[model samples]
Target: MLKLDHITVVPPTLAEGVRHVQDCLDIEVPFGTRHEYMGTHNHRLQLGDGIYLEIVAFDPDGISPRHARWFGLDDQKTVRSNWDAGRRLRGWVASTNDLRSVLAKHGEIFGTEVPLPPENPVFAFAIPKDGSLPLDGAAPSLIDRRGVPVSSEKIPDRGAVFRSMTLEHPEPEAIERLYEELEIDHPPRVVTGTEVRYRAEIETPSGLKELT
Candidate 1:
């Protein structure tokens, strides 16, 4: 079965992102390591369940990626605009064990099968050359851990549990086709909308909270 691995919160910077999450969930999130290849760093909070919440942003000192960065971070205009307004949720990723077959069935959804950076432990699919996903980024990126267990237990707990995830897109059926092809067992709910949007509902230490 496919699993919801982690949801990404793309802030202008890692500190701002951590603040955003802490403010909403009323829990302190610890920092994670940098993705040298993607030029991004993060603060992560384990959801108690297998899933985790990641607040990722570009690392100023990190080298520029030779290719497009992940989680739509390469788009400085959008990132800055959103950051200026307020830090918020960006997108989510799903994990599948059989990535090769899953990609073969739904490769077009991810664009192309770009190789993961050596530093990235879990296998992940990349945004295509233009750095766009099927519904212009509403769709969750696919990943395969190859039996590597996620260390969610080691992560400091703030009492967050994932409840549901929803992905809205202009063409709901197109996104549906991608899900059907990949056969991800617990994929997020699909909805029709004018533009791509992602939302995740979690039971936090304080109360039910949303990230979008």
Candidate 2:
């Protein structure tokens, strides 16, 4: 079975991404390591359960990847455009024990499963080799974590708990089937829109707030 592991917030830059969380939620997000393989870095925050939040962006200092970078960060202009529009919650990742099974079932629609180094200990079914983010980045990235520290043990909590997460896409039926296939609870909503949008309601020290 698959479970929601974390939500990814892709900003134009890591600094701006961190600032958005601080400005909007007034919480300090701890810096996570640089994903050297993907040429990206992130700041992390705990949101109760085994789930967390990652604010990811292209690492300005990291070397370029031989293949297309994950999360569509390969296109600088697109990243800037999204940032210019506003700080929005972009995508999420799901974790499963049987990674191969999940891939075998929906690899084509989900994307290619690229195995990371043993030291890094993650198997990412990122955007397809052609580099198209499925459903315009609304589809949750599939992951298989190997012997990694749990979020509760690794990330320091700053008094925030996830209340719910709502995803919106132009065509919800396809996504609904995907979610059902993966066993996602309280699945995303379908709406008449051009883009996939998401909002995560989190309870913080300042009461409940939406992470958009």
Candidate 3:
């Protein structure tokens, strides 16, 4: 029911996030849109095949929402803790057509769906009540685009093509089982590790590069 949409890089700040991507892929990501409702912003780059990469961070100038911010940005302590641990290539978002159905079946794992930009909402994103990552980044975050695809042209392309992503988790078997149940297409490869983290292989202008 779900497919890979984009990979995310979480950092302490927007500039740091962009720099992390640049250091990894050796290309500067272009500025993307800001989520006024969610009170965050991002820098994005196209990665071919309808997939992209984003460096998302909290927008200090943005008005804080009543609810928890997405991607666990509201939890600055944990965000910095993960960043300091070198888990920069943190998570990925998956697109689903039947978000309500998925949430009905796995609401605890994916969280409740909320329409963004409340007044004139365009899409529904599943966010945990505490705004934590799905399985703490062991699994993909869910996004229902309302049947509209994110335009690759709008996101700059620096000759980057997503090769694959791998996830390291303490309980790889559990995560693997969850992916099987989700029926996800192009899901990240999951393996055993001390903690949850992700590594993506991308074909960039400088040749194949790994973004952690």
Candidate 4:
């Protein structure tokens, strides 16, 4: 039901998020767009092959949403803790065609579908009620773009190409089973670890680099 969409870095603010990504990738990602409905904004960079990296954070100047913001931006304490722990490349998102059916079967893990923009919605995203990472980032976030292609020319391309992604979870077996059930194309490889985290290898203009 889903395919690899993009990876993400959730920071407390846009400025911090940009710095983190720039320091790691050795390139500046151009501003992507703002989420007026979610009260957040982001910077994006293409990782080649239609994949991209997103640095999203809460927009202090934007109006607060009725519900919590996505990517756990509402919880700055945890976001800061994770960032301080060197978990910059925090999570990943998956794009799907049948978001409704997928959520129907796995709402507990993937969360409910929320049509974005509040007005003239163009995309729908799966966000938990508390607006937390899907399974605390153990599982990838789900997005339904209403048949739109995942790869886009809009995002910046600095000659960065994705190589591989490895997801670390304490219960690797459980996460692996979930990925199999979801039939996620290009899903990250699961490995046993003390905590749920993500790491990716990307080929950049400067050479191979790891984003975490």
- Candidate that scores best on TM-score: 3
The TM-scores, one per candidate, come to 0.85, 0.89, 0.98, 0.96
Tens digit per residue, CA lDDT, model 2, 1-212: 67788888888888888888887678879998888877888888999878899998889899777777777788778878877776357877777777778778777766776777424645645556755556566677777775463557667789889888777777777777778877865555555555677888889999888888
| Candidate 3 structure quality by residue, lDDT tens digits, 1-212 | 78999999999899889888899899999999898898999999999999999999989899899788989999999999999899998899999999999999999988998998799989999999999998888878999999999887799988999999999999989888889999998788888899998999999988999999
Candidates, ranked, lDDT: 3, 4, 2, 1
- Regions more than 4 Å wrong, model 4: none
Q: Sort the candidates on TM-score, descending order.
A: 3, 4, 2, 1
Q: List the residue pairs that clash in candidate 2.
A: 89-212
Predicted candidate 4 versus true structure: per-residue lDDT over 144-196, tens digit per residue:
88876755777878889999999888999999888999998878999999897
Span of 10 residues, lowest total lDDT, candidate 1: 130-139
What C-alpha lDDT does candidate 2 achieve relative to the native structure?
Answer: 0.76
Every candidate's lDDT: 0.74, 0.76, 0.92, 0.86
Top candidate when judged by lDDT against the true structure = 3
Report the C-alpha displacement of residue 133, candidate 2, in angstroms.
Answer: 3.3
Each model's backbone clash number: 0, 1, 1, 2
lDDT of 3 at 39: 91
Cα RMSD (angstroms) for every candidate in the order listed: 2.6, 2.2, 0.8, 1.2
Task: Give the alpha carbon lDDT tens digit for every residue of 142-189 in model 1.
Answer: 676677767766666777898888876788897787776566667778
> Which has the better TM-score: candidate 3, or candidate 4?
3
- Whole-structure CA lDDT of model 4: 0.86
Model 1, global lDDT? 0.74
